[model samples]
Every structure is written in structure tokens, then in C-alpha cells.
Target: MSFKNYAFYDKIMLSKPVTVKGLTFISVVGITIQAYGKYGVFLWSTITPKALIVVDSSGDISFYQISNDTATSELLESITLLFAEE
Candidate 1:
């Protein structure tokens, strides 16, 4: 897989300065998927026009043409199958 952007988070900028050492993974109201590197990719669900937002390591964002949520799942499954078939 390839990435188009990078994202960073800094807690020092906040007054609270929450500290958590080591590798940490947290999912809020949505889902967060980490690729092969130190970057994160999240899926956002919207209502108006059902879209799949892909955020890469360099802060580059991409929207794919997804008909619905089910379509997104199918696409991911298909991709997995493709690799499995190999």
C-alpha cells in the first residue's frame, strides 16, 4: 500500500499535556487503521453523500467513489481476496 500524506499529533500544545508512553491505539466514535508504517488511516462516515475518506502519512487526503457503507466493506474484502489469491 502507498500513502499520500502524513499526520502528526502533539499533546504539549495542550494545557493538560496528557502523557502516554509506548505504542498506543485508541478509537473514538470511529475506526482507526494503521498501515505498514507510523501513519494512520481512518474511515469517516457521512450522511449526505456516503463517502470514504482516506488520510495518509503526508497529510494527503483522498476520497473514493463509494456507493454505500456496504460497498466499502465489499471493496476492502475484494482487495484482501486479491492478495490472498496471490
Candidate 2:
């Protein structure tokens, strides 16, 4: 998926989302990819959009797109991260 322009804290409504193990995966939220060699990607956001993204050390990604106001979801590719290259 490509990077999308979204307003901070504004949630996105997805019609179709990827389902993994009976769980709907969505929220392809763009993160500020911090470049650090050995440590891998570092993400530190004070405030972000409603959709949440969890990334592990192995570059493994888990998308939690459900918004706080209303539950939500979206579709995403395997370990595909979209953001500004730092």
C-alpha cells in the first residue's frame, strides 16, 4: 500500500480489511520511519491517528486500525511500510 495523507487523530473508514486468524487487520497508518541501523526502525509518536500500527524488531508489522469512537479496519500487504525515508 502507498502512503496516504491523513489528518492526525482522524480515523479512516475501510470497506474491506485483511482478516488474519479471525482478526480484521486494517489501519495502514503512516508512521515516521526513523533510521537506525542495528536497532532497526524506531517509532515514537506523541499523538497519532485513530488507527494503530505495531512493528517489531524483525520488521514484523501488526496493524490495529480499529478507531476509538467506532471500530474500523483496512487492507495491507505483508510488512509493507509507507512513510518518509529518513
lDDT of 1 by residue, 1-86 (tens): 66553333211110112224432222111223332333666533322333344545454655464345446565555445645776
Q: After superposition on all CA atoms, how large is the RMSD of candidate 2?
A: 14.8
What is the number of residue pairs that collide in model 1? 8
Q: Judging by lDDT against the true structure, name the best candidate.
A: 2
Model 1 C-alpha lDDT versus the unseen true structure = 0.37
Candidate 2 per-residue C-alpha lDDT over 5-28 given as tens digits, one digit per residue, 9 for 90 to 100: 433333222233565555554444
Give the Cα lDDT of each candidate: 0.37, 0.41
Backbone clashes in model 1, listed as residue pairs: 5-56, 5-57, 5-58, 5-59, 5-60, 6-57, 6-58, 6-59
Q: What is the Å distance of residue 85 in model 2 from its true position?
A: 12
